[model samples]
Target: MTTLQPDILIAGAGIAGATVAAGLRGRGYSVVHLEASTQPLDTARGDHLGPRVVETLANWDILDAFFAAGAEKRLGAKWLTPEGVVIMHSSIDDLPLPYPFYVVLNHDLIATTALDLAVTAADYDYTLFRPVAARDISTGADAHGGVTEVSITTPEGEAVTIKPRMTIACDGRSSKIRAACDFQIAHTYDYEKPFVVLFGPRGELQDPRNEINSYMSLNGGVSRIPRIGGQWKIGLAIDKQDIGRWKSTTSDERKALLAERAPALGEMETEVAGFYPVIRRESDYWTKGTTVLLGDACHTIHPARGQGMNFGIRCAARLFDFLPDPTEMSDAALVAQRLADYEAAVKPLTDAQLSENHERGLHMDCTGPERMQAEIPTLRAVAADPDANFRYRMTMAGYPDRLDPK
Candidate 1:
């Protein structure tokens, strides 16, 4: 078994991990990223960086690459009532930013691009190893609190130790590193409404508009988001136990459901279908000594608002801002302080977003009498005020303030 020592050790090479690696390297921090998979996972979910996220990417000077990797630029978002009435609409052009409203790209492509940038950046030094799993973590007392050592097992079953000044966990919702450090996470999993997602050719659907279309009723809610290559992504919230019923529902049954619940989608060619359980996890404390948690590792939110990855990207951007000066402290101390500041700065914002999204989900998925009651006020208000529609649109796109740092 071979051992390697680096200034910093990162777990997971997803968007959060890749973004931090690239940013830290640009800031002159040595980083090594480890991943358990040699290739990208074949998951339908990907990061959808909103306008604010785009601004941060622009600052890193890599937004163009994201666009180049088949990201569809969104002009605005629209909210529709069950009767196919447009309640509100918001455009990206109104936002004061360097780029367009937002870019929706495949998650794998974005992560791969970020990783590629980090590996090739001239300003910093870094390394990437895949098929490696972190099995153990140890911390020792130091003048500045302590140092962390991580043990990883490669695909070949060889164990290697990475002794770094500090370690950051970006390893997604089920994080081994967070568990190893004994970090406590306050969380809630809403099994009431699970989701089934489908993806396919855009031409297979009716009224396949480029804009994001949200259809709401008392029984549930469904969203159809357009993507590059004439593709469209569909998500519907249903009872967790009923997920099996959806699977049993023939393609014709699904099409019929779409036609009934979402008439705008007259027809669609589904290429794939997936199921996801809704979960929300947050840690009151995101750091412990030389170890810190980031991205999904630190917090996991419901995917209703499409803010899961967006939140993670924002966390990484904040970590970049709080990075310590290498000259003023040892590598270990620098990493510790940076991790502390990262947690302090990110926790509050994440908590607020979680609350907001949870509420939004409930409002959008109202059914029966509740749906009628909710739509009456929204529809009446939109008709009464023209600006009301615009404001609603902006709110969905994460308006007013961009995701960029304040």
Candidate 2:
């Protein structure tokens, strides 16, 4: 029905995409963001933002909006034993960062709020193609060896070609653009089990120690995150094979299952909200000429630590850091260099985070009937050791293992 071209094209309007679009608009760059789903993809996922993202939000001048979106302050991480005894907790309260608190806000809120802020930004030039998807891509062989144009299909069965200086694929793990384009997945670590999250009201679940809690027993573990509306998010680790069986669980069956595994989580009267598979995958090269991968597109990791979305936001920040001056436009070389510079600064950090997450998933993803009970004492000791505790708090506080931009 209509045609539009912009300086930058973003696929997927999730937190990462919206952050990139919003941050760039503040830098006076025109952007186009595409969303495949007709409505916002609201899932009970990525609700925790560590201090890094909290600081990043403030830097982008959207911290107020993020807080206004109704977020519960996550004081720190707490790991509980089967009997609900606190085994370990490293309070991030003392972290020397600008934001020392982790805010638990739902994806829909932060993401939609991000888009809203982008819309009201000074001189915002953005176009949204909802319920549309990129079906194919055309690439050029010259300066940026980047995508020339992407053919997207509208909901009404119309195809349109839009060209952009840079196309950012922020479409999560199953990025259609990354699939259609020439990006290569250099490394992939797929879990035998995916992280499954079930949501229900904060009914009668005993909350005497009502903190963001990880309830682990000998019979697999579940994490309970308190949401804005007295709702609790139940996170489960389901093996890859049992994915369908778990997804097909009935409403009552879900409650029963929740009561069985995470009895402390009260009852889950509602059906499963979402089941997300955990995988750590990164492209060999995030930027190829004019096209660059952002967010989960570049590094899709397990929810071991709460750094997935934070990492994606960092990517957007680095892109904001390296965006070329508007007047430097037609110099394909300049655009290519900017793209490459962002990637150069971001990819190494992503690699380290991805590797670190892989290890965390292996140790923390103990879903067997027998909990990692035996390792609890050792872990408790580590939590008690002054140096080890500092290190743990530092890492758990969202400190980057490597801060080098190279």
Candidate 3:
């Protein structure tokens, strides 16, 4: 093991960074994980790990532990009109995939759990530095004109330098390494803001057979997803400009708004879980010299489909498939090519996915009687149509475009 410097430095211990770290280290690569936050993680965002992601977890052999830690398995989801009519229901129960269901777990827990396992695995060479951030960064040159040295400061104000083979920026959209390095982004800014998340007990709808239910109407759109231990996680897609008005509302007032928006799902406990912004931010390139961007650092899609982290996991898996042998790390060109390959494989597919999701979010934000009349019927027809509905379920299951030719 190169104790003085690891082969790879993974910035940000969220889903993407942690997944890649655990993944590469399991294959016996040396990795150093850096995370900025010391406080307990709020693992509430994007709990739905679609069938593809669940299969990835199973391949990593971490699914069992995830379930043990209270992750729920869901076969599909249902889209409903506010009056409780099912507009569309997507299922994966019959798929031949390893896990024909979405795995619902706290994102923070999955990352931490995977990290914990990687750290303790008997043969994996993985080190973790939490509550530490990249205070300063610079690329150090090597004989081959590659960036070979990277530096950071620990939480105790100690300076440390790493001659890593590669540095991965998995930090979220606001990535420190990304900012310090200034990776150019090609953004598709869809609608933003007024997105709210509510978490509490199983409000009113609680059933083992029930898939995720997204109720929509002229008022707004709210999705209620079931969780393990009889809890619930819900998301709201609303007008971007009304975010301030939302923030000023009381819990009771907020609950009332959800009632008006989602409707018919029954009442939640009026406890605020969390709020997040939904934005579409995609980077122009995935690699620069020896550094690579993964997850939100590379691309961020709207949360309407609950596919943000799943897409990141997909990036991790594909990148894992394309990773170079540790001995080949000295070839900067080769590293950049590999990152490019991963990006090439993932970006087109994810770009399409994000665009479709953005359109879906737009459809979900309808707030007028006329728009509702136009939307509900259109949704019903599409849901009834074989090809489109198949695509819908396939997308929800994380395997978009899996329809058999008719």
Candidate 4:
């Protein structure tokens, strides 16, 4: 086995991992990024990047490239009844934010674009190993003892040992690195509503404002988001028992099912993408020793609010804030300390958002008046209260840190 040592090791090349890899490389950090999948990077989740993510893109010098790659901008979002009656509408146009619009693009496009831009950095000195899987992870002492070493296998059937100052696990919900490090989940909430994703040509619905229109009722909910290239991405909420029926359904049958469950989206012809479980959970700890967890590896939230990718991107940015120029630091202990500091500064925000998301998810996927009864009053009250509305807009727009209530 060949042994390699790098300043940092990032396991996974999804949006979260790519964001961290690109951002760190732009800052002159030496990193080794590993991706277990030999297939091209394509995911069904996280197409909507909240507004604040643009700041990080700009900082990494990829803002123009990001938009140039067919990303669409959305000014705001609306809550409506399935019959097209608006219940609540929130706009970011008046917010005090660096960017006033969220972006919509394919999840794969974002991940690949970020990594592609990272290599173009003048001081880029990182290695990306694709089809490389971390087979073994050994943590010394305790969770705080950090990782002593990781054994990875490459596509070429060669074995390599990696020792790093720090290791970040961004490998999604079932992270091998997180499991190997023995991090336990302290809080978890499995949302009763499950959603199936769909994408198709923009129907007769005229969206001059380019906003996310979410239709909710006793039958269910349909969140219609505009995609680049004049298409629409739909998230159709369904009951838990329907998950099995959805899986066994044919494309045409799926259409009929949509019509029955979410009438607002059923009329539009769209292809079924896949099912995404709505589960909100967080690990008991984010960092141990020189090891850290990020994105879905540490915390996951409901997609109803569209904050999963946004929060992950912000976590990467916040981690960079707590870290020094890698060249200025080489001590493993110091790296561990920075990891602890990063978790300290970011976890509280994540916990609060996850809790709120859990509550909101409960009101979705209803088949009766309970959903309306639970949601209408809350939505109307928020809209009636300017301060509450402003805060809501800020949080939903990906500016939780800047929520200054008047």
Candidate 5:
């Protein structure tokens, strides 16, 4: 068995983990990241990155590369009727932030970009173990719950033991580190309808300003998210009872159903990406001793608003703010204190986000005329009112407090 020691050990090389690794580079810290998958991650994951997520990328020196890689800009979000009548719209063109617009790109591409830079761009010592799985973990003897060591087997069948002062779990919903640490789930909210994701040529929808148009009606909701190169990612909410038929239907049949449900879209050549039944969940705590949970490992929410990746990236940046320098890794008590501080600062905000997203999911799941009579009017009102529209836009841009006079 080979033994290695690093200042930080991050499990999983997805967006959250890669962001943490990239942000930590040039900070005089040694990092070891492990990825169980041999190839790249699924490309069909969340693609929208909010303004705040772009800001985080800029802070980490990743914005230039992201855009250069064909990431597109979305002005804002809009709500419309199935027949293409606009109900409400929120544009970030006037936002005071540096990067005022949202970014649309493949999730795996961005994560891989960050990981590529994390490994090669900086002079810091960073190691990535691909096709390797964490087989065992041992926590400290104290009650604070820090991990002492982790055991893994490399692709070459070599046994390795990693010892780090701090551990970060970004291994997605079924995270092994989180389970091993015994983080209790505090709450969960499941959406009533599953979303069918389809991607293909943009057809007549050629405007970037209309990229995030959401159509809600008595039938259901269908959203058109534009991608770079004149492509569209369609999100259609499927009834639970009709899901079996949807599964059995051909590609053309699914396209027809989408047109029937959302007439504004008409018929377009597209491919079904995947089906997602979203569930919002949050853990009782995000930190224990020197171990911290980031991204889907700690919390998950509905993807309708495209905040999951943004929240994860923001969490990593916030964590970087609390972490100590390489020289301070030996101070176990101090590290533990900092970990506690991180949890205390971030958990409440994350919990609040979970609640808000759960509410939005419930709102999006509505069918029939009740949504039009009740909720549609309120949304239109919010859009029509200047101050209300500004506040709503700011919040959706991930800067809810920017409106403060202070």
Candidate 6:
């Protein structure tokens, strides 16, 4: 088959992959992006990015594009109890910094914008290969240092050998590149519940005007996220065993359950309903030879706080910071340094976020007398204390200034 050589080879053209590619291209690095899917990714997915994620996008000079692409400015987030008691409210405008707190945009639009920028930039030198899959990766020591040979299957199903300076896997959780490299994935499984995400029109929600609203109920927890085009995305967590029953139930039963859990939703029409088991996994090592993992391939957090895509965006920014100029150093050295810096910069943030989100999920799912007696009082106290609420808001905003490299 045909053989090609590029400065860098990136697998997966999702948000993480596209963002990294755009950053590297700006720095004059040649790249080849391989995307397995031919169609554009679903825009509805990953529609929100926190302030930190916004800052990262700004650094790449693409924030304006994102905003122009119909990204809605999010004011803040609100937390509520089963009885609709407002427990906590955090606003982005309240932050000491001037950065936008959050932006809600179609993920597909963002990816497409970044890709378009990368492909059309004045110094565009990267090639995007669609319908391409990386099947295997072989690493070897070279006179300079280390080299990785990647075997990619093209749309025609022919295996083509591509020897890039390095391979960055921005693939999602089930990354074939990570599997081929045999990287150890450290994961914590949360079987507490399965969640069904419903996307559709938002009828009427006054309390959560331009903000996300989360409700903790005795039966379950639900999060309502506002999206572009006046659509709202709602996630309802249910017992794992109840998933089958929920799926088997008639459409009317499901609709009734939605009404029962989130009465505020009213009569909004649902366009789609997707369900999946909740899981969190992180790679022990982000690098192996010339291959490195980024985004969900490296770590995955619970969707409770809607931080999965945000975390991936941060990882992409870290990788952008560590990327080396191909002309300045050997491919092997650049790859190693980039991988080390990426792991060093991202692991701690992701680890802490994973832990914090797990605890938050547990707290939100709490029920029974123990919750009413212990958790509710503690939450009320935390909510009542201005200092505590301020600190909580800062933490949720990602403490951007504190992300200094250690």
List per-prediction Cα lDDT, in the order shown.
0.71, 0.74, 0.73, 0.78, 0.82, 0.72
Kindly give the stretch of ten consecutive residues in candidate 4 with the minimal lDDT sum: 200-209
Badly placed stretches (over 4 Å) of model 1 are: 143-147, 155-159, 202-209, 328-331, 362-372, 379-406
Which 10-residue span in candidate 2 carries the lowest summed lDDT? Answer: 202-211
Q: Which predicted model would earn the best TM-score?
A: 5
| 345-404 per-residue lDDT for model 4 (tens digits) | 888877887787766666564546777677788998998999899988988877777777
- lDDT string for model 2 (1-406, tens) is 4555677889988889887767675565678788887677575778777777777888888788877877667767678875568888877776666687877788888888888887777677877778777667777864367767878777667777788777888988888777766788888887767777777665534443235777766677778776665777777787678778888888777766666666655444665778776777877888888788888887788887778888888667777778788667556778888888887777786687678788878765667754466666767997788777777776665665622223
| Candidate maximizing lDDT | 5
> Against the correct fold, how does model 6 do in TM-score?
0.88
lDDT of 4: 0.78
Q: Each model's TM-score, in the order given?
A: 0.88, 0.87, 0.90, 0.92, 0.95, 0.88
Ten contiguous residues minimizing lDDT sum, candidate 3:
140-149
Candidate 1 per-residue lDDT over residues 1-406, each given as its tens digit:
7777666788988778877776675666667788877778445775467876787888887788787877667777666776678765656666555665678777788888888888888867687878676667676665133336777776667777888766778898888887877677776555457777888765543432357777765545677877666677888777667777788876677787777677666476564467877777776578876777788888887777788778877777777677667554355666677778877766776677778887766654444557656665775687467566555545555553433323
Q: Write the per-residue lDDT of candidate 3 for residues 225-311, one digit (tens) a residue.
A: 776667777777666777677768776777778778666645556556666766778787776766778888878777766777888
Give me candidate 2's TM-score against the actual structure. Answer: 0.87
Q: Supply the global lDDT for candidate 3.
A: 0.73
Candidate 6 lDDT score at position 146? 29
**How big is the positional error of residue 124 in model 5, measured in Å on the Cα after superposition?**
1.6
Worst 10 contiguous positions by lDDT, candidate 5: 202-211
The C-alpha stretches of model 2 lying farther than 4 A from their native spots are 1-5, 152-160, 202-210, 240-271, 369-375, 401-406
Candidate 6 segments exceeding 4 Å error: 143-147, 156-159, 202-209, 248-252, 266-272, 329-331, 361-375, 400-406
User: Per-residue lDDT for 1-406 in model 6, tens only?
Assistant: 8787777888898888888777775676778888888788865556788877788788888889887887778889777774567876777776675584788887788788888878788876898878786666666664123236777777767778888777888888888877877777776666476667777655444433468887655545677788876667887767777777876766566666766655665455664467867777777788776677877787766676778778777777767667677685355765677777777777786687778887766754553345445655666787798777666676677674453323
Native-structure RMSD, model 6 = 3.4
Local error of candidate 6 at residue 13 (angstroms): 1.1
Count of clashes, each model: 7, 3, 0, 3, 0, 0
